[model samples]
Target: MNESSDLQRFQELIEASAERELTEVETAFIGRMGFRSEQCRQWLEADAEVVAAAVEQDPLRTVPAATTLDWARVDAGLRRAGALPDSRAQSRNAWPLLPAAAALLLCIGVINAILRDGLSTTPQAPPEVVAEVLDLPEGDGSLILHEGDDEGVLMIILSNG
Candidate 1:
């Protein structure tokens, strides 16, 4: 059985059109469902028969009323058989925040661009270059460390400039 085509036709009939005017695809589906196309076509081809027989027919005179069938097993069995694995794939949609995100990023970019010029133009004072040129509390001349016994040393040469 062409499960995909049959399912697609049923879906299209439910979504695209009503049951009154069945397309070729929908006819094929009803055929698979055990409905005779020739019987329905003969009934439809009879104009006076439709108006007088189907429409004007007394409800009490009919032997039995229309009946609805329960087909729960079809869907459950098809799912077990993996008839339409990709059916759920069509329903998923990506997040819709891209345009808003782009706008927010553009605002941030504009703000950053505007502030960059101001920050770059701001005056920055040069380093003193002579901090702690005097001696320490214990007569230390500079920020230097002297070690012994194979220890490390940190030397800071002071400049008057």
Candidate 2:
């Protein structure tokens, strides 16, 4: 039969198989069409060694097929073969860089602290401002005081009774 007819037959077999435990007629029909035993194996009791061989040969084999196998070993093998990147080396390499980076940062911080402390603690030379005396307007009792910083008091006399 053509591919289209084969596909149609395959779909009908799957729908019939889903309704109940596979009947002999369905199994015969499936086997005649050269279908894989993987789905049909569910209808029969599987040998442990046979199932394990399948899992060992192909890690992606069905999980129930793998139930009889040593999973940890298979899992490790699959991870090694799979695309998952190995991060152990990267993590190990990064750990060493952390202390080095921390040491660099500590050195920079210590240098900055020393510079800041030195700049702040050292006294600055006293300032000098030019001062000139000026007269107040008549009848306005005002006093302007220059207390070393060119800034001081400016106030009017209070006429307290």
Candidate 3:
């Protein structure tokens, strides 16, 4: 048979083997053909480590493990692209209240300055001085008068005379 006919027969035999209906003659024929192939001999002579590396790698499990997306990097990129603000920018944006706080402090300082100037400009007068004279019970003691304050108001004291 030609090569194409041989390949068609090989595919039909593979399909029959997959269906679990290949006869012993078909199995012996396929085994004989595989034994005669140079590719089959090379596969049998392949390094153990290379065969292990190729066989142990499962694309279903390893593909997802190798290609997982990093969520933190994605979030940072979103922030940089202006899709969302990070916590640091949010805190910085809250600084608009500083001017109001400074205004309040300025008003307090102005009120304090006005009250100080108002108090310092006026003169405080001394209280009115009143005097009382008293006599001691003992006879033969003298009464003394002393002045108090810068205004020279008299304070009377009585002793036995």
Candidate 4:
């Protein structure tokens, strides 16, 4: 092949190398061309450096084992620095009982209101209800009876025919 064809084949081989491994013959051709041409030699050197760097082990990649901690010592230091409250003072502070006390007071108020307004008065008589019988078509019939919204105070009946 002439010089132009040689250059074209070399270019094709270089482009192919980017996507797949070059064959031994193609690699030998590239090496021979690199030796004869300054630009090819520089490209080959740059590629070699890139591959070497990629394959080299990184020193920072391996992580060191975690150091053990003394939690008692850490707590002591924090207390000395006033970053944490004293253990005795924390226990003596009855702030945690405030929620329970508020809940007790709310219960007492609700009971007092119920006693004042709900059960102390005399009970009233219930209004009278008129019952009606429905004439349904003759078929397979079912009657369903259930308690109403007032639980034991009222009842509801449904019939399907």
**Model 1 agreement with the true structure over 44-75: per-residue lDDT tens digits:** 35576666776656776665744444344555
Clashing pairs in model 2, backbone N/Cα/C closer than 3 A: none
| Candidate 1 segments exceeding 4 Å error | 1-96, 119-121, 124-161
Q: After best superposition, candidate 2 residue 72: deviation in angstroms?
A: 5.4
Off by over 4 Å in 4: 38-161
Q: Which is better, 2 or 4, measured by TM-score?
A: 4
A best-first ranking of the candidates according to their lDDT comes to: 4, 3, 2, 1
- For model 1, give the 10-residue run with minimal summed lDDT: 145-154
Scanning candidate 4 in windows of ten residues, the lowest lDDT window is: 140-149
What TM-score would every model get versus the actual structure?
A: 0.18, 0.23, 0.25, 0.25
Given candidate 3, what's the lDDT at residue 160?
29
Off by over 4 Å in 3: 37-54, 57-161
- Winner of 1 and 3 under TM-score: 3
Instruction: Please give the range of 10 consecutive residues that has the lowest summed lDDT in model 3.
Output: 131-140
Q: Report the alpha-carbon TM-score of model 2 versus the true structure.
A: 0.23
lDDT of 4 at 6: 67
- Which one wins on lDDT? 4
Give the Cα lDDT of each candidate.
Answer: 0.43, 0.48, 0.53, 0.56
